[model samples]
Target: MNAQDVINFLQDNPSFFEDNPDVLTQITVPHHTGGQAISLTERQVSTLREKLAQVQGKLSELVGFGEENDSISAKVHHLTLSLLIAESFESVSQSLYTHLTEGFAVPHVQLRIWNSILKRPLPEFVEVSEELLFFAADLQRPLCGPVQQAEVQAWFGESAEQLRSWALIPLRRDAQVFGMLALGSEDAQRFFPEMGTLYVERIGDLVSAAVLRHIG
Candidate 1:
């Protein structure tokens, strides 16, 4: 009666085709490329081929994702080993900066420690605005996107103007946030709200543990 009804009837009675093989030759459907009407059998074959191509394309996409994850995991592993062997706060900073900037190719790194326990008046101990400290404390996960705070951008010093994007990782010790490690790049697309932050969050965890050793 209707196209859907015919489809349902054919689906329900799959043996109908085998019982009436002549129907396959009589039925003709428009060709996928839109020229002549082809036999139903030919159309079915064409449909299956299209489905197979789509499945293969999806499989290739999945393989690409797997390779990307493996690569990022390896880089994170290398950073872990580098931090594990660091002897002091200075070395920890060196190893973290070196691994992220050189190994991961992040162009700029900014670290700020706000805990009063940081007795040394190093650059890290430089005063941070209460607003920033609150923002860091409120972060449940790493923030990835265009620079969220303009003031934070100025912390990068001379490169502030050129840095258009940022990944702000909140460092926490004993569940309390203490500081932030900011990664900066000139490319706006380098960091965005929709981007995955799994590895960046992992970096935050590693950095927090290493820095807390001396200042916590």
Candidate 2:
């Protein structure tokens, strides 16, 4: 639970400790006492208090973490909305790069579109890298960051250090790939199979619609 949640829970359930008076063994019983002796020792109670304090510290950390996560999620949602509002490939790509870097905190990304009928690359192409060009030729749908070192090395040819992780999303209309989005990051573990691809796929759907609207 987050810091606020943990704190609220503790506040509401103060009886959790109070009900178990043996938790606070500060008082000692006489040798010939009429009442039952407490099982917990003074040192044990002190340790429990220390443990509770640690839980409180972790709760505070979770509070901060929850806030950061919320911020990131909001930015991503905004970017997705902007993508839906875009009219052209240029606008979409610009907004996407800006959102990736400024909004989502990603490092770098490249978008490539291949017009099947025209047999030409989009205007955005600035001498496509050999690896990217090859990837496009393969026309893989929804590629994620490589896990193996060899795969990673191949994707990032010469300036591999500049890019760590990447996601290649193919834009298709009627099952034909017309464009691709290549997202890159400096962190190797950013994109993985365990993560959800719903957002990227949604972006792909928009890209595909845009491509058909523009070219068809």
Candidate 3:
């Protein structure tokens, strides 16, 4: 009979193995490694071993990711507590910048605010164009990847030219976006389109809330 017919017969008669147990030991299959033949039992054991190895590998990878995420979450929590304790907008900015640069190893960070009343003039109070304001408003989430807009990159000053990647987070109070936080790195892959933005978005939210408390 044809291979399919034989397979169908074997499936249809599950008791055939019980009826003739010798056939289980006598049947042979090609070894997966390609050098020799193996009995059905040996082949089955080999297949199971390969599957187990794959499952163990995946489990290890998952565990590594879990540990990394836990570390990041702890850092975020610490930063959040620091920001909440900051007495003024300047202190909040300082804390945010310091933690990001020292704790997170971010090379460059820039904060800019527009259309807000500042009690004292700060570098972050620099004028932003209508185009940039519109861009900030349009962002529903943090933008991460290679810096594409020259004006946006210019916000980082002299290092702008060498910055290889960026994460742009729009800072908003209620529904109105009034500021932006730019993070840059020399490594091109530091921020990429495929990377998750959950932590960055939460940072933006925290910064926005803290800054809004000071702005008129």
Candidate 4:
């Protein structure tokens, strides 16, 4: 019989090996590593071992991801505590920069508030393009990917050319977007399109609260 026919027969007859016990022991398959021919049972055991190893490898990868998420969550909590103690708008900005750049390892950050009600504003309250403000308002979630907004990219100063990826988060006041927090990274894969933005969104809300306390 052909190889396919034999495979079909074995698959169709589940109890064939029990019925022909001698034939099961007598059947030989080539060794996977180019060694001597091994019995069908040895090959089956070897295949199971390989599958188990693959499953173990996948489990270890998942464990590594879990540990990474835990570490990031701890960092976010630390940022939240720092923001809580902030007594001024500048204090809030300083704490955010320290936490994101030092604690979270993000290198470039730019914050621009277009709708602040303050009579006098620092560099943070600079006027931006109407189009940029509209774009920020359109975002339902934090946008993560290659840099798309040219006007926002110019806000990074000397680091603008070096940045390969970006995360744009809208800061909301009164459920309306009034500002944006831009984070830039040199690594192309740092802020990929598919990356999760849960922590990013929380950071945006924290910054919004801090800013709104003084200039809402």
Candidate 5:
């Protein structure tokens, strides 16, 4: 783990090893002699160090999750501010898409509006695979994270791998799905449900409102 993560994890889990006194004794010292306790030895120190390394690895995983969550939070904040100040839908969509791709380190992204006349979702942005680019644009209902992945992969086959993980968040207004913002990363884990969705959902709500005000 990095220095900040190390400090945060240690502070948060001060009692992580409390129940396992054997592990504690391996790293701690006896307060008094012949008091039914023993001090750590050189061998114990090595073992404790090994355990520390393992714990640090877990902490690093947490650090990564924290980073993604923080990125989404920042992007949502920026979008909120922009909405309050902006005057046009095009400007808002462009800014939002750029922020989404950059903050998530995704290589491809698209924003689309649900086209009721065509009975399908139409692509507002097309990158990489064009064959299935407009698949999610026409869906009248909100597509959740899991279903969105299935639909894209089903339409594109092997080509979807080039974009890796993808998330289609429905932009809803007046209880209707008006549009969606799709974010894609080369890493499959980037859009997995295990990852935080606070930012994505918040962005979806903003996009929905914008679409309602401008397109709905």
Candidate 6:
């Protein structure tokens, strides 16, 4: 009979192995590793071992990812505590910059707030164009990738050209976006379109809350 017929027969008769147990031991298959023939039992064992190795490798990778996530969570917690202690707008900005630069090793950061009423004028409260304000308003989440806007890149001053990648997060209070936070790095892969923005979104939420508290 043909291979499919034999397979159909084997599947149809589940008791075929039980009826002739010796056939299982007698059947030989090519060894997966190299130039040798092995019994069907040995080939099955080898396949199982290979699968087990793959599973182990995947488990180890998952554990490593978990550890990395835990470390980042701890850093976020520390930054939140620092923000909590900040008493003024300047202190809040300083805390954000210091934590992001020193704790997270970010190369450059810039913040610009639009349409905010402040008791004292701050550099962050600088005027922004209507286009930028619209762009910020349209963002549903943090934007990550190469800096596409020249005006936004200029906020980094002399380091603007060297900064190859950026992450822009809109600072929102209620339904209005009052500001934007931009982070930059020399490494092109530091920010990418496909990268996850969970932590960055959280940072944005924290910064928006702190900034809103000081706004008049």
RMSD of each: 1.9, 10.5, 1.7, 2.6, 12.5, 2.1
Best candidate according to TM-score: 3
Write the number of the candidate with greater lDDT, choosing between 2 and 4: 4
Q: Count the backbone clashes (under 3 Å) in each candidate.
A: 0, 1, 0, 0, 3, 0
Best by lDDT: 6
Query: Cα deviation of 172 in candidate 6 (Å)?
Result: 0.4
* lDDT for position 137 in model 2: 53
Candidate 4, residue 105: CA error in Å? 0.2
Which whole-number lDDT from 0 to 100 does residue 142 have in model 5? 36
How high a TM-score does candidate 5 get? 0.54
Residue lDDT tens for model 2, 37-113: 55446446656888999999999999997897687668767876887788865677788779877876766665656
TM-score of every model? 0.91, 0.55, 0.92, 0.87, 0.54, 0.89
Colliding pairs, model 4: none
Per-residue error (Å), model 3, residue 31: 1.8
After superposition, the stretches of candidate 5 with alpha carbons farther than 4 Å from their true spots are: 1-43, 60-64, 115-161
Candidate 5 lDDT, 1-216, residue by residue in tens: 799997898699888667566765566455333344455654466568889999999999999988967866786787677765656667667677666657546566666654433322334532324333355445543343344355555444465667657677767655555555666666766677566566667777777776556554
Model 3: what TM-score?
0.92
lDDT of 3 by residue, 77-109 (tens): 989999999998889999999999988899999
What range of 10 consecutive residues in model 4 has the weakest lDDT sum?
A: 114-123
Local error of candidate 5 at residue 80 (angstroms): 2.7
Clashes, model 5: 3
Give the per-residue Cα lDDT of candidate 5 at 151: 53
Error of 1 at 81 (Å): 0.9
Clashing pairs in 5: 120-138, 121-137, 121-138
